[model samples]
Target: MVEDPLALWKALRNRYNHQRTVILPRARYEWTHLRIQDFKSVAEYNSALFRITSQMKLYGDTITEEDILEKTFSTFHASNVLLQQQYRAQGFTEYNQLISVILVAEQNNELLMKNHQS
Candidate 1:
């Protein structure tokens, strides 16, 4: 009954892509709503962000820097509030700078945990 395997493949691909596009906004919304309190560790937080971004990247030119930044900053946890305030005081208004500060803070937290254990 496989009269046209290539055609069937194209149809399935189209359906999958359509579904992906349909949910892109919802995915971004969930990501923006994700809070630092949701994760107990830096690895968990980073992994969640990585996964969401990887999925969104599949949409090619559709994802925007503003969207990513809004999600990244809006989901700040209590631990990150200090860094957020400090960065703002230092005039670090750029999204990239904020990401860097957050990553560094995560690394520092990891090191502190390791040292405490040792």
Candidate 2:
């Protein structure tokens, strides 16, 4: 066990860098194929995004937020055309803002359905 936190972090980062060199190609391919419309709900999509981003950051070296968003948006499936249009039309420059819009839309849709049910 390393007594120094910084040293431990450095050691872990070095190990990750070694693994990343071997694994990044497969990881990048998988990320490219991941599409927003493949998920049935915002929550599911968000969870998958979180998982991918966290793994990429931890083992695939540091990626910029813009790069992540670009990779994510690159895979937007046909079913998400409307959402894609919204994104383009609104010109959202940040990834988090796009996530917020999707989540809020999901919540609104759920509330509308519940209201109709009542």
Candidate 3:
């Protein structure tokens, strides 16, 4: 029972450090294989990106917003080259910024599709 928060955090970190041996290789593999087009939806891809990156970070890998942004833009569908370029031009500083735009665009596209079907 550590009364100090910092000490408690350190204790927890030490206790779980051994899991790093098992987790790092798997996390790295997932990170390498992750691609946007593999997912059926933006949300699904976003969730996976975070999950893998969080694991990597837990094991001391440094993941930046630029890394995530480039990974996403590079994996955009071939037909979406212009769209990818447009997003890059926007210069989003964070993953959430880009994801929010994507989610909104997807939602708006769905609404347009529903209207077209009616």
Clashes of each: 0, 0, 0
User: Which lDDT tens digits does candidate 2 get at residues 1-118?
Assistant: 8999999999998877677666666666667677777888877877877776676777745767787677566667877677777776887778888888878988999999999999
Better of 2 and 3 by lDDT: 3
Cα-based lDDT at residue 101, candidate 3: 98
Candidate achieving the largest TM-score: 3
List ranges where model 1 is wrong by over 4 Å. Answer: 1-9, 14-18, 21-26, 57-61, 89-97, 113-118
Error of 1 at 98 (Å): 3.9
Write the residue-wise lDDT of candidate 3 on 10-106 in tens digits.
Answer: 9999998789999989999998888898998899999999999999998899999999998998998898899999999999989899999999998
lDDT of each: 0.68, 0.75, 0.92
In terms of lDDT, the best-performing candidate is: 3
- Sort by lDDT, best first: what order? 3, 2, 1
Looking at candidate 3, the ten consecutive residues that score lowest on lDDT are: 31-40
Better of 1 and 2 by lDDT: 2
Instruction: Name the runs in model 2 displaced over 4 angstroms.
Output: 1-26
Q: Among all windows of ten consecutive residues in candidate 1, which has the lowest summed lDDT?
A: 60-69
In model 2, the worst 10-residue window by lDDT is 21-30
lDDT of 1 at 96: 63
Q: Distance (Å) between predicted and true CA of 38, model 3?
A: 1.1
**Pairs of colliding residues, candidate 3:** none
